[model samples]
Target chain A: MPYVKIELTREGVTREQKQILIKGITDLITETLNKDPHLTHIAIQEIDLDNWGYAGEQVSVLREKGITADKK
Target chain B: MPYVKIELTREGVTREQKQILIKGITDLITETLNKDPHLTHIAIQEIDLDNWGYAGEQVSVLREKGITADKK
Candidate 1:
């Protein structure tokens, strides 16, 4: 069984958005790995800005510095 | 930054159990990967028996057949 998890900032997520993501990711992984959807487990996770960091700084700090999604 | 996610069958789980798991996993990953707890993100997702499957059948179906946690 292939367990898939997606991580993103928990900013704005609607039930509809999550539903679409679940379906899309399931389709993508099943297609790529040739695995059955029944056996594929997908989990979506939302991360708080302060709890996640990159470039030796929290995501919140990076945002304060006007950093875009990409690394500076 | 490392993101860890744990997936288990949603049969019997308590808030205390999840709390313990999150801390233990966070510590393990931080120590093994040399990452900061502030930078490490952990998410736990529980799956329903019907939504999870194995051995070419739904987990619920397998349970009906008296299959153990391990494969037949």
Candidate 2:
């Protein structure tokens, strides 16, 4: 069994995005690792900014300081 | 660095339960794998039943047929 997990900050991701991610990942694993599509499980986790920490600071606090993942 | 991801069906898990799970898992990893707690990451994902599949059927459909994880 191949299992993949994706964690990202809660950013209003649509259901279609999640479905595409799952399908894409499943296909990648099947092609790259020769895994069965039916046995591949992908779970996407959306963590609230307040609950996610980076660089010793909460992501929510970082966002207040003009720091965000989308910023270049 | 140690990372753990737990996936469960959306069943109204309380915050306290998640906290306990995180703490317990952190302790287990530290004790067993000698990993630093600060570098450990734990994510709990609660997925909608329709998004999770089992036995070639969606979990929601299985639940409708009275097949559930907690029934055992």
* Candidate of highest lDDT: 2
**Candidate 1 positional error at B70, Å:** 17
**Most accurate candidate by TM-score:** 2
What fraction of native interface contacts is shared by candidate 1?
0.07
Q: lDDT by residue for model 2 over A35-60, one digit each (tens)? A: 87778766666789999999899999
Question: Which pairs of residues collide in candidate 1?
Answer: none
After best superposition, candidate 1 residue B68: deviation in angstroms? 19
lDDT of 2 at A65: 93
Model 2 regions more than 4 Å off? B1-6, B11-45, B50-72
Model 2, span B1-72: residue lDDT tens: 988878888878999999999999999999999998999999997888656644334566668898767845
Q: Write model 1 residue lDDT over A1-72, tens digit each, in one string.
A: 776666877666654566566667777767888877777655556789999888789988888888868665
RMSD of each: 9.4, 6.6
| TM-score of candidate 2 relative to the true fold | 0.57
Q: For residues B11-44, could you state the per-residue lDDT of candidate 1 as single tens digits?
A: 7889999999989998998888888899988888
Model-by-model DockQ, in order: 0.10, 0.14
Of candidate 2 chain B, the 10-residue stretch with the lowest lDDT total is: B50-59
